[model samples]
Target: MGKITGFMEFERLEEGYRPVPERLKHYKEFVVRLTDEQAGVQGARCMDCGTPFCNSGCPVNNVIPDFNDLVYRQDWKDAFTVLDSTNNYPEFTGRICPAPCEAACTLNVNDDPVGIKSIEHAIADKAWEQGWVQPRIATIKTGKKVAVVGSGPAGMAAAQQLARAGHDVTLFEKNDRIGGLLRYGIPDFKLEKFQIDRRVEQMKAEGVTIRTGVMVGKLPKGSRVTNWAKETISPEELRAQFDAVVLTGGAEQSRDLPVPGRDLEGVHFAMEFLPQQNKVNAGDKVKGQIRADGKRVIVIGGGDTGSDCVGTSNRHGAKSVIQFELMPQPPEQENKELTWPYWPYKMRTSSSHEEGCEREFAIATKEFVGENGKLTGLKTVQVEWKDGKMAEVPGTEKVYEADLVLLAMGFVSPVATILEGFGVDRDNRGNAKATTDFDGGYATSVPGVFAAGDMRRGQSLVVWAIREGRQAARAVDEYLMGFSDLPR
Candidate 1:
């Protein structure tokens, strides 16, 4: 809208990355952000589509066109304002989100879409630099207390919103620090920890009480997932102490491959391996941390987590890194005609994949071959999908040597113990049972307990988690006061 023929005049310019060799030596963000001039040019490419499919395509329903127009006009502050209105953590999403909004851009039909994420990143960074992002403290204090269990994006969003709504909000985290997955699961090479720490400080300034190393419920014994909780508060205590409780602990149960040799010493879940590196990057001393140095590492699963493993392995100076995908390789390019205005299925090569990796698609592990309680290799076979069923190809069996195997399969659901502790019903998928209704949405079968984010919706993107958190905050506000003015 800022420039009528701007879309035709400017070609899409993507953000650059540091050289692979230089970046691999350290764990730090490598994305080169767009300069103001570059961002303005990218903003100019936003077509004034009537429908604005990108808004709907974004999980948080960001005002894309408004921000694009603001950027095009060089109104950086207003651009940040529009972006912050919808997304509580643009820095997080701008760095990691796959940018489905771009995929749904109208210009994508016949040309390269606008660089929306880069513009967002620029806006957020500029906002921070200009001191536009500051504490929004509530003037009036409601004589009510709320407990948010989990310090991930959903819990953080809910706590901030509720606190701003004049309610006393306490955020509990089991780990020693805030930011559930973002602080640990994601590699620093992609997202630096200081980004999360700055937000935590801002939340504190906003009057949200943060309690780290505190578990709201008991963790199952022998749980391998990370937990540094020094004290556990019973669910009954939370219900008795707080007016309401929001469960945003996220799905921590990592899916496992139950083939033989699963108990091998070298076999580990991606969670176990990832958190150690994050902790190390944070300058914490970890005992017996898992390392890929000089090891033939095999990462199973073809999702973001697997890609992360590949990157970390490369950083660890692994002997060789190989990734296995059970599904067939997707097309290099999606058919836009059939998939326009929606997320398209296509081959995605992450920065980690580009660094170095041997990717094997449509391969299934038959068995883990090991000796003396240690993994040595994997017996796999190529698989094909026929009639909606997977079958191994005849004479396709092969074995690959491996010194270590990391299971990067996605999570199945939240740990049942926490949900059961709260006496909340679970969906068929084992997530906490809760709805997103305006009147009483986010409320569980229990009267005062509620759920949101990955805990209620199963594993999902961070942007979706923030959306659920904000909507759930409004639901909780309405539940408390019989009405709410907070935006959903």
Candidate 2:
């Protein structure tokens, strides 16, 4: 719909990055965004298919075709409006989200899809540059008080929506800063803290009360999860103060490897390593920060988190870096016919991997070898899968040298004590037990309490978190008022 033959004329263009040597020196964002004309050309490639599977493919269900067409016409303001109608934080997703929308595009059936993510990035940056993103204050007051726990994307979206609907909303964060993982877990080079700062300012302008450094409930004693709360508010106090409560906290429990030498001094969780650098980058003095400089680093678990570890280690000037994955290597290209319009399985390489790293697939760590109470190396064996079970090859066992090790095996669930404090029911997987049914969606077993995002669905993408937050807000609005005008 953008142009009669635009799909046939233009090729998919990718966003650029700064040179590795130049970007490694600083912790600022290094992405080179596409120019207005390049973005328009990328938008012209959208086919505006009859079904538009990209809508459903995207977690927030963005109106992809309409926005793409508008971008092609150079109507950037209208494009931003269309984008804002569905997604609350395109800036976060445009930079980091694995764009399933592009995978589901009609053109992707045979050729490269439209550069939807880059176009989205352009539109969001353009809107902010032109001062179009401003606080939308409520004209009338509903006088209903709501409490939203966590300051992650989900809580942020829910708070913004409820504030727009005229509800008195108070967002609580345990961390000294507002953003939960976005503030600490994410590397600064990927997304700067200023993005979160501007959004917080806008939320304050819209009458949302933000309370940082305050914990709603207690965490388990000796818990490793990051917390900077200087004050504690019991769950009873929160429930008595607010008419409705929404728990949108992230899944923070990191999965651990219970192998020998697990307690070695040099072995640490990914969370412990990543957050320290972010604090230092924010100008906070972190005493005895984790340093990978001149150390041999072995990162276990091959995922985005592991990739992040690789990038950070390289920045710290590590002597060497190696990554391990338990599963066998996938084909470089996916079988499109089998996985059309859905996420496909294939070999993937991140920019960090390009910087420097050795990748070992179908390998499992058997034991961590250490001396002087510090990690020195690890013993591993090659593994093969048969009938959905893994078997280690006997003769392939070997030891690799390492002075530092990072476990980036991903999160298991939200911290247990927070849920236990409120007496909310949990599912088999240890997530909040709540259905997404149209009637009483997101409502917990405890009356007046609800859960969404990682608190309900376990760990997932930021876009998915935003979707849950928006839908949960609608559910809360309907519970407060007989009907909700909010979009799901």
Candidate 3:
């Protein structure tokens, strides 16, 4: 508590963004960061409540109050130390996380919450500038080999942790580079590839072997999810070569819109369209890439992915961009009294949404209307909830012209073939079946095999992925040495 009265004296100030006109012309990060002094002021606004719900609200259980106090006192190094203790990738979370911690902030109940995410961003950037972010090499070698399949946040965190614990860790990725989704799934306007490259360099310096363009197991035939694997190693070979294997591959099976004319040309899955642009941004030439230029684009599904499509389409100079949500629009703000200390349902206008978009809520697509195998328009109807069931309005059926349709529905589960190759049991939801308990947690039905992140819990936030990775690392460590000294 650097300043007990600071919360009463200060109002919340969010980070700024570049002007939309200027930012829309390029595919780079546009959000302006908080200066050191601004971060200090924001940190001082923390009330340092007895419960400190922001800590629990954060997926990685960061010591929020301690970092806030440290930042408020101008102890920047200590602030980074506290933040890095819980989160291995604070930069990623600071940039992209929805900040559920803010929703659970004690001050949020009666006033604006402290700008914790902005302060975190400032601290992480400052730490990097000051050369405080360096490789932490283990002192002793354990003579144990651990194989981590997938180079996303979870796999990276687990590989780093296991390497620091003196185990020989090898990380495998199917893509030509590291960072499973971060490198390709996310747009460069949100997160640049250099951030991932910097961390990859650090991980390599920490003695972790990173193998790219190598798939750990076979993908199902005709699967469309991104994969540049020129070589595939059998699961049995991995189990035989490594002391333990950790599965951190993310859920890649996108949920499809199986309606009439789904097979029409110019209609594509969000993954199919988004990754091409990302590849182009990385200076790779893509053949017959999906373009939105001068086209009437309709993005189905209302979520982050859909919002991303909106942004990318705008960048592509699409003629018009429209987004549809089947659910009713939420309130602009949540009732804090009723939803305090938990993630609340409220209308969230992302930076992408603010750029430009026509949002339609309580709407459902009836069928994709096409002519001669190319998409032309779609038939839709307004819907209403009656007794918690969806019912289409009788007279609200309408048609809208469209040149391209991007289905941004979220992913369903991990690719089935990889899970099947390892013989890992699956949950009812089709995710890898594994527990998060302290005793033998993250262990699959098969011995010496583990699962974490999206592979175990289905698609979720990056912060959640890091949390699971750290916890799974501790579990794997315990399994290896009969006990673990690593933090969970």
Candidate 4:
């Protein structure tokens, strides 16, 4: 610990956001990161607890205390070194990841947890600004070739690791752009696209071959999920060329609400709506773009995706935005004594919510009401838990006018085409079936195929994707050379 009693002397300080009015006019990041002094102070707040629960709490098992001490001592480079050792993209996680590590912090038991995410953001940004982040080109070329399907976080991490391990790695993406979900799913106001661009450039410098606009497997016919592939490679051809294949694509199968009027014209999946805005932000033209402008928008689902819809709707100058959550609202605060050192169930309000969103909890949409094949409104009912199931309360039916309905429900599983193409086994939930065993983990039933991230574990956080990617790289490395020195 850099300062034994420093925790007692400092209070948590959060990063600031630009004014809502000014930020809504453009799709750019509004978060004002912590300055170096503020980050150092935040680092000082890391207590000298014997067990660093935060390390275990983080998906990648980052060396939290070491980086906190390094940051506290103003050793920015070493702090970044420690951070980079674990996370491939601190910039991505620092911006969007909900810090589970903070919830598991010792201080969170009674006091505010150390601002680990903010500190990591500062360190990552400083590292980039100081040119500390550069290409780690391999000096030795191992003769193995690896194919990474999907250019999202997991695929990107795996490709970079295998490339650095001296293997020829080619990352394939269906979209015209490299980043999978991050390139399209997330709004630019939360995470700028340039962040991904720089990393893509770095990966290229490290000898990873990036092949965008290339689909290794077919997408379902007429699927609305983003795909701009100009070329297609059969699974057999891919497997023949690469010594190992890693499936790191996201779970693109969005859960749908199959109520009445689901065929309405203005009704859409969050994926269908989100990617268009991102493409527009990237200067790509989309025909008949779904806009929330002057529309009464109803976003169903209470997760991050729903929050993103709210934000994007506000940016579109929507007339009104309402978000519905099927579950009852969680308590504003969690009972620390009972839930310490673990993620807590509590009310979470995003910056988007604060920007102007009427959130309705314990509410379920009964039916989408429309006329002339266009969404006009929705019928809803107040739900309550009876015994162990949600039951609609009597006399609680209501209707709300809405011009656009965005189903922000989370994804159920990965698209079936890729798994079918590879002939890989699927778990009960339809995710690619694989184990995380140290000896031969991330390996699918197929001999040379591996699966990781959302494709293997279902939809999850970016940090989890990075962890899976790095570990999968190790598994592939060992499979190729009969030994691997890569970190798991």
Candidate 3 ranges with C-alpha deviation above 4 Å: none
Candidate 4 Cα deviation (angstroms), residue 376: 0.6
| Model 1 TM-score (2 dp) | 0.99
Q: In angstroms, how far off is 104's CA in candidate 3?
A: 0.7
* All models, RMSD in angstroms: 0.8, 0.8, 0.8, 0.8
Worst 10 residues of 3 by lDDT: 177-186
Instruction: Report lDDT (Cα) of residue 24, candidate 2.
Output: 83
Question: Which residue pairs in model 3 clash with each other?
Answer: none
Clashing pairs in 4: none
The models' CA-based lDDT, in order, is: 0.93, 0.93, 0.93, 0.94
Candidates in order, TM-scores: namely 0.99, 0.99, 0.99, 0.99
lDDT of 2 by residue, 214-261 (tens): 998999998989888999999899999999999999999999999998
Predicted candidate 1 versus true structure: per-residue lDDT over 1-488, tens digit per residue: 64778899999999999999999999999999999999999999888778999999999999999999999999999999999999999999999888999999999997888899999999999999999999999999988999999989999999999999999999999999999899989999989999999999999998999999998888889987789999889999999999999999889999999997788889999999999999998889999999999999999999999999999999999999999999999999999999998899999999999999999999999899888888899999999999999999999999999999999999999988999998999999999998887668999999989899999999898889899999889988988988898999
lDDT of 2 at 264: 88
TM-score of 3: 0.99
**lDDT tens digits, residues 69-93, model 3?**
9999999999999999999998888
Query: Where is the poorest 10-residue window by lDDT in model 4?
Result: 219-228
| lDDT tens digits by residue: candidate 4, 404-469 | 999998999998988999999999999999999998999999999999999999999999999999
